[model samples]
Target: MRHLIPLLFLAACASTQDPPRGPSLPDTCGAGDYSYLVGQPARALERVLIMEELRIIRPQTMVTMDYRAGRINFKISDQDIITDVTCG
Candidate 1:
């Protein structure tokens, strides 16, 4: 009986689908779509809406070399402005 309870709990926690979040992200990152954000203040990104992962890179910030598909990268210049948008 104890095993049955644990098995049931596992089943309830198993999920193979996107949560209630609106839509699934694309297979590849789309940097161009966010090009408009360039020249904007980095703080603006905090209020930006997105479904994919966002990585904010500031000047001299050490980041991982590993690239992940569908991940958006925002590079901030020393002036705190968004200098570039790339998909990693």
Candidate 2:
């Protein structure tokens, strides 16, 4: 029985999934597609500000961006896991 308890504890500790945190973006944002916004100068500036709030991209950081399904996909540092993104 003691051994079983230790084994269960080890098994529980071994799980690697991160806990759920919160929403991907803020509530105030209404924009839907960033690709076209990237072309417009004013929207680009506003997008940068929103991205900062979302922690999706940092100021002056190099990120490969893509527009997918009305969201700005930001790839930073080469991990498949998306760190941050913003709505278009």
Candidate 3:
């Protein structure tokens, strides 16, 4: 198993590197352009169409930890205000 351990170590080392920049960025999902949406009423988004996978996360809501490429997350506060706009 000595030979296998070294190969596994190298594999683990490669995985430690930062992931490549992809369409998960704010611009990719157009979340950056919508930064102004923060602090506004969450209902304001109803008129804005983000032609990608959109998710609205409310307070105390349970969400999947899985990162979905090009997904835009709109976080809402308990008072129905937009808190954060980010890409997944």
Candidate 4:
């Protein structure tokens, strides 16, 4: 039908304007430590107890940083890549 073409185009344009999708970020009370061994716990750990009180904690994701053609690059996925040179 003729109406289908315009509907498809509108849907395609609408999707492009949305922000990146993934797991939403949790609230942080304040800055804390996120290191290992006998010294102190991570900043995230300070807000709540681990393994005993709260069980909803998830591991922090590892990001890969790189440099490509004079630009700094951070890649989260095959489709998710960011490049910046202003801070460099």
Winner by TM-score: 3
Which lDDT value does model 4 have at 17? 65
Question: Clash totals for all models, in order?
Answer: 0, 4, 0, 4
Q: Residue 70 in model 3: shift from native, Å?
A: 0.1
TM-score of each: 0.64, 0.26, 0.66, 0.25
Location of the lowest summed lDDT over 10 successive residues in candidate 4: 79-88
Please provide, for model 4 over 1-88, each residue's C-alpha lDDT reduced to its tens digit, 9 standing for 90 to 100: 9989999988887755668698733324211222221122323234543332111112354433431232221112232222111110
> Each model's C-alpha lDDT?
0.86, 0.46, 0.87, 0.31
Error of 1 at 60 (Å): 1.6
Candidate 4 stretches greater than 4 Å from native = 17-30, 35-88
Candidate maximizing lDDT: 3
Tens-digit lDDT string for candidate 3 (8-34)? 988887866688887544366778888
Please report the TM-score between candidate 1 and the true structure: 0.64
> Hey, what RMSD does candidate 1 come out at?
14.1
| TM-score sort, best first | 3, 1, 2, 4
Error of 1 at 13 (Å): 69
Model 3 clash pairs are none
